[model samples]
Target: MALASPTVAQAQSGTAAQCQTSGANSVPELHKEWILVGWDKPVAGQSWDFREKLGKYYDWEANDVVLYDDMSPDFQIARSPEEYRALWESSFQALRRAHHLVLNGPEVIAGDKLSTSTLEFAARLEPPESQPIISVRARSTLVWRCTSDGWRIVREHNSTRRITPEESRQLFGF
Candidate 1:
């Protein structure tokens, strides 16, 4: 499924209205939608196409954007949009199937220009061809800034811990 791209003016106004009315309360739903888009099954013989959504969801043009993931090397920072894209693309390429479920609060703190939220989620990742599926529970904090384009993520920190197969079954009912 293709996501529709709103005109710049529409995005700006829509973002402002969203901030004024729902504030960061709407971020969790948006996050879920993004995850749904990310997890869309790829066509045979093709890789997942995330370039458009990546541009829409992230503030790639911002110099201050940063991402830290526990899965990455210790102290390794993805400081540029290209670095972030590389990381995600490489990770997605290794996965035959990926399932991510929001398991807890996106407790939010909203401000005029920025918003922060924390989310807890469970992930079940299946590797290529008969490999064992990996399951984990993770927590992430995201900082979003209202920019000319829309509400874009500027900072993120994520940590994860592996879950036992039984625990994964309990959480996801696979």
Candidate 2:
């Protein structure tokens, strides 16, 4: 009997993504997932993929993740796993439906078991036919920690500036 070869995802040279580590632990999978879900177009099974990974990555007991989203008027604090999951799901539902999303210029710093990253990204939303296009260029900061399971976000904050009509024309080719 011939043995089956391990798939690339399993036999790859390194982890899914890379982050600055002072010669220590790396949370590549978590990093990659973050980028993909942030910018890439929605893909089949992505919602479930995020659900499973997030459940494993977040520290439910500590529940330290605080999300300050530009779209929300109040800060969202998750004190438990369920709360975190719900918040994430709600956010993902909206993001996953975006017409276009792009992540750019991400910089990350890693320490003994903690890391911080910041990036600028853009998202465009176009409603049904004969509607206007809305876009935003936002800056986001994320703080992550390495737990026994893996790396998990402890804090996140995002702010955005709306793109003017001219800028929108250039951006969306309207």
State which candidate has the highest lDDT: 1
- Model 1 TM-score (2 dp): 0.79
Q: Estimated TM-score per prediction?
A: 0.79, 0.60
Model 1 bad stretches (over 4 Å): 1-25, 39-46, 73-75
lDDT of each: 0.72, 0.57
Worst 10 residues of 1 by lDDT: 37-46
Candidate 1 lDDT tens digits, 1-174: 865567865776676765542633356555555554654433433466557655667787889989888877455789866677777776676677777788987787877678887888888877787788888898988888877565678888889999999999999898
Where model 2 places Cα greater than 4 Å from the true spot, the runs are: 1-32, 38-57, 73-96, 99-103, 127-132, 165-174
The deviation in Å at residue 160 for candidate 1 is 0.2
TM-score of 2: 0.60
